[model samples]
Target: MEVGQVLHMNAGTGETSYSNNSHLQKKVISMTLPIIEEAMTNLYSSTSPSSLVIADLGCSSGHNSLFVVSELIKIVEKLRQKSGHQSPEIQVLLNDLPGNDFNTMFKSLPSFQKNLSSQLEAKDAGPYFFSGVPGSFYGRLFMKKSLHFLHSSYCLHWLSQVPEQIENNKTNIYIASTSPPNVLKAYYSQFQRDFSTFLKCRAEEMITGGRMVLTFIGRKSEDPTNKEAPNSMWELLAMALNDMVSKGVIREEQMDSFNIPVYTPSLSEVKSELLEEGSFSIDRLEFSEISSSTYYNEYNHSDVSEIAANSIRAVAEPLLVNHFGDGIIEEVICRYKEILLGHISQEIIPGITNLIISVTKK
Candidate 1:
């Protein structure tokens, strides 16, 4: 399914802003830049490269896109300047689902470019270029051995499609409690398969020794025993969907077919996949759990509660609309808001319940 086309409208929480995400990105980049520099150096072994191609996979709309891409370029430019080599032209590719809000991304590009241009003018850096490659990163987006550096944050783990078993099981059981034993198996199996494909695709697209840094959410549990295990946040999300279903806001069938496309990988799992894809060696790997508090911060009193609920809706409403039908969406979203607010105000602080895993490719 397309990114926001199927399950949740904003399944990836793609609406997250750069300001809210600065801390996470900063942390990931600190661990990633060195790895990228080393890989790029290896890739350009004998030649003095003129332009650096940095692709940000799973790049969503809003300021985060501009923020991350600009940051990546700045780092690369700084490195080249220090090395006394004329900076290579920068080619930045922003990727996301086919249906992503390109208007926001496109509109922001000029400003991003203007900022980069100003910086280059300051350092006597050469002209830099930027573009958007709209497609799923689970598949190839570039020609063989083309990209010099690739950066993906909180994006690599999304499977290209929901597991077929889960999709087919819609009529067999309720969406809430319905996933067959094979749902997660199918999901993980596809993840391994798609991830292997992604690695292979990147291996093909990235020049040998090219630099690729990836940061994504991971599960604390080694692996889920089944599709419904507590370790899978998708399960909690599914529960939220079921609640909507119970309230007649969604169809049982819709719930069955809808699934969040994200899959959190364990550190070991990622290492194994990277190795299987071949040619890439992990230069660095760091995993840290972050607070989920970011989820609740968007709302203030009514607005805060409104968005805290809407944030989940941003992800879920799309799915409900796709499967259950759009008519129930507003109702579902409203109910979702009320329920989430009640829980947060009454039960728990909105916090991140995820681990960040950053990997450097050879």
Candidate 2:
């Protein structure tokens, strides 16, 4: 599948839009605030740049996009005040796939800039500029040594594309406990390639001493197919699809051919890739458990199944629509909701494993 052309979160502020369902992402950003602030402080202390260039990779449209930039600016301003140095000009770049909803994000920029301007004015800081760069992060997105800081959340787990050369894996859509060893190897190899490419590209784009803080779905287990790993979510999703196939809504052959281009790497897998690339030095690597109940608490009135289905659809709907016709999208989601509700009702749900890593360019 051409992820660049089809992969994007649901657009607009509708009930099912990613903008509405991204509380989890917001919580993640909040959790990583200390890391982000520390990185910014270190960047400022190490070098006094006339202009600070920051990029938020995979910055899907929402309040969170500007929230990150705003927070970073505050950190820089505070440090500037303490040292009595002139505040550096800020350039914030929001990046995502080509199909991302740049319009929604751009429309909100005026107000965001106004708020940023007011905040900076109170502290005698320089002006803040915002722009959108549309493309994949697996390749170069910026000029050599142009960026000072980089941040990405809930994005790296997505492989550049699905792996090739698998056969007869009809019942699963991801690397699960039931997947063959070859399938597991294929996914891991793909992640190694994609992540190494990511680090290499960023190494060229960012200056030495630059810092990056990234958070994404991952697993604590070294085994990719651990039942408690994030792959379990995909397993549940596949079960929902299989139910549709059993009822004649979608063909079994279609299910067999479908695979999600996402992988949850273990800490060892991530560290290996970082060391192989030989560009970034790991500063911190940690895991946090995000409760499924968080989603439940967000949409208290909505059924658990409905909330889960919408959350998945926000990210996967575009890909699903590309594979299966739009005609079956609603039905597929309905069945998925029902299945997820059943699992949640039985308390069989596995909470998400979030991997937060902070690194600096060597």
Q: Which candidate is the best by TM-score?
A: 2
lDDT of 2 by residue, 1-362 (tens): 78778899999989878998787789888988998998888888999778999999999987777788889988998898888888888898899999888999999988887787776645567677888999999999999999999999999999998899766567999988789888989989999999999999999999999999999999888888887735766787788788888988889899999999998999888888898889998899888887777646545434667767788888788888898888888887887787777777777788888888899998
TM-score of each: 0.79, 0.96
**Residues 174-284 of candidate 1: C-alpha lDDT, one tens digit per residue:** 222454667657767877988898888888888655677677766555644323212333444455567877877566776666665656666778778777876677666
lDDT minimum window of 10 residues, candidate 2: 294-303
Model 2: residues with Cα > 4 Å off, grouped in runs: 119-123, 294-302
TM-score between candidate 2 and the true structure = 0.96
**Per-model CA lDDT versus the true structure:** 0.60, 0.86
